[model samples]
Target: MDDDGVVPLSGGVMKAVRLHQYEVRPLVEDVPEPVITHPFDVVVRVGGAGLCRTDLHIVEGQWAAKSNVALPYTLGHENAGWVHAVGSAVEHVQVGDAVILHPLATCGFCRACRAGDDVHCEAQAFPGIDTDGGMAELIKTSARSVVKLGKGVEPAAVAALADAGLTAYHAVKKAVPLLHPGTTCVVMGAGGLGHLGIQALRAMSATRIVVLDRNEEALALTRAWGADVTVVADGSHVATVLELTDGKGAEVVLDFVGERGAEHDSWAMTRRAGSDFVIGYGGTVDIPTIDVISTERNVVGNLVGSYNDLVELMVLAADGKVEMLTQTYPLDAVNDAMDDLDAGRLRGRGILVP
Candidate 1:
């Protein structure tokens, strides 16, 4: 151990869930402890890390072409922890402070970054996908990626807020400008992201929020989170949406499941001149050219939010405007957590604690 009481990476080891290949299960084994390699870097002793569907896709190698990550990498994006140690140059955070890890590292000099759209920076590194992440006892990250946790929020629940809640918050905020007192906002897929999407919309806008999900339990949870109406996935889903919107269709549709069917439904649920925001990462779609030209509907892809947005979300969480629903598992139960998430057996979100 070093003077700061952090185990030195040169000789110490920590357990991490590592993916060796595509379509194979990640193996939890002893790995070299991550070290602070940059002047602004800090090492965090992870308290909890949330499992996401994107981790599943990465484990299955579905994103290899787009992400360009190599095999045998650690996988986890949503994480919160206590600071174990910090480099000399790190100032905002110190050892022993509790913080939530922001997974995206954006180049601050990019055009999009200068315009306050750091999520779309020309150079971006996403933890768990592009680099090693916090599905372990300790993870190394830059000071810029750490956000101090507020009082009264449990670390395990806040773990889900790092990604699932923050992503949904960003998507909902984008639609806020379009939402009016009488307008309807449709949220498709009421699982992890969609559930939070419902809460974020309710907290940030006055639009009539409608939630759609194939699972009855998920729909019930959505209603519990302040959704005005809930519609189960079925042949008559579009009809139900049309009825809810009084045959005009929703003014904004946030598709939390980007599967082909969900994308089609999002388009079908939107009003003629409405906006459709795609935030999920599962499948693709092939919309007909006529559909775009005739309806004049706008489709936008939402990446995860910026660090600033995450800070704003933390404030909302601190103020109790947003609530995080999560189930906890010890680090050894990571596989079970992933299985529950994959099977849709979890009611809310799943977090792995170390």
Candidate 2:
């Protein structure tokens, strides 16, 4: 590291995909490699950076006001790689260690962090959203954000777990206590997160898993991942779920879409006193207050997982219980990857490799 806090780039520059303008495609360009700027910082050699739909929203300015991230930052929240360098204060991981990053860089001493709820840390930086992120040859994170992968686990194989899988795991983990052998856990919107939610629910609980998606293929894929039932997300889907659950609705309904009237359907399919965990965004959830008071339903919001949550999720990934249908792309092909993701042409999460 130099006096200016910029470490000398051995090769002078590295390739990265940056969002130079809101509502436009990210540009792949040569940029300086990241360096440790703080005693707790770590630089990761990017192996796989998962392209998420949130990146699309960021590019569209949906998150500009919320994240308040400056322009022209590299974008990729789901990251996994080997540790290339570490600040002096970092000790749990060292160079050459394969790791996945928790999306949030948080202070471990906060009350929420102390409670293992780092997602709600008083102060946090959401990489790829609120700061420069991985979609590059190198990325910078903090010591508290790195989780070492277990044996036989490669960075690319589990990169999507960084955010997408972690979020899914977090939601399912919350639903575990409410679920039992005969109970039904319905996952709405069998896309990237929904599919992963199915897998996490499968590995963590014995609840009968019901997956709903407009895409027949996504529903089929969820079935293979241990969804006990699949429902086409037509208008009648909610009624179908109620019928399947003997008119009691599902014990838990995780709304991954939470848009296009899906929220109403999700609420309709949730049983009395059951929980509705909202993960995905982009729509309004309009419900009558009478239903809330009569049903005693719990509406919860789910963000990404904590550092410890990532560690537990990695154990499931390393054991082959949860896997990502990763579509790999070179760093330069980020535009094409984003196109496929936006067009719904990609089957699973898109992973950019250096």
In terms of lDDT, the best-performing candidate is 2
**Candidate 2 on 189-220: residue-level lDDT in tens?**
88878878888899999999888988898777
lDDT tens digits by residue: candidate 1, 1-354: 455544444538989988899888898889998886566678899989998998888877888898788878888899998999887678988898899988877767889989988778898788788888899999888787889887655677798788998899999988999998999999999888988888889888899998888988778777778899888897789999998888989999999999848988888888998998999867676678898889898898897888898999998888877888788988888889889988889877888888
Query: What are the models' TM-scores?
Result: 0.95, 0.95
The stretch of ten residues in a row with the least summed lDDT in candidate 1 is 2-11
The C-alpha RMSD of each candidate to the native structure, in angstroms, is: 2.8, 2.0
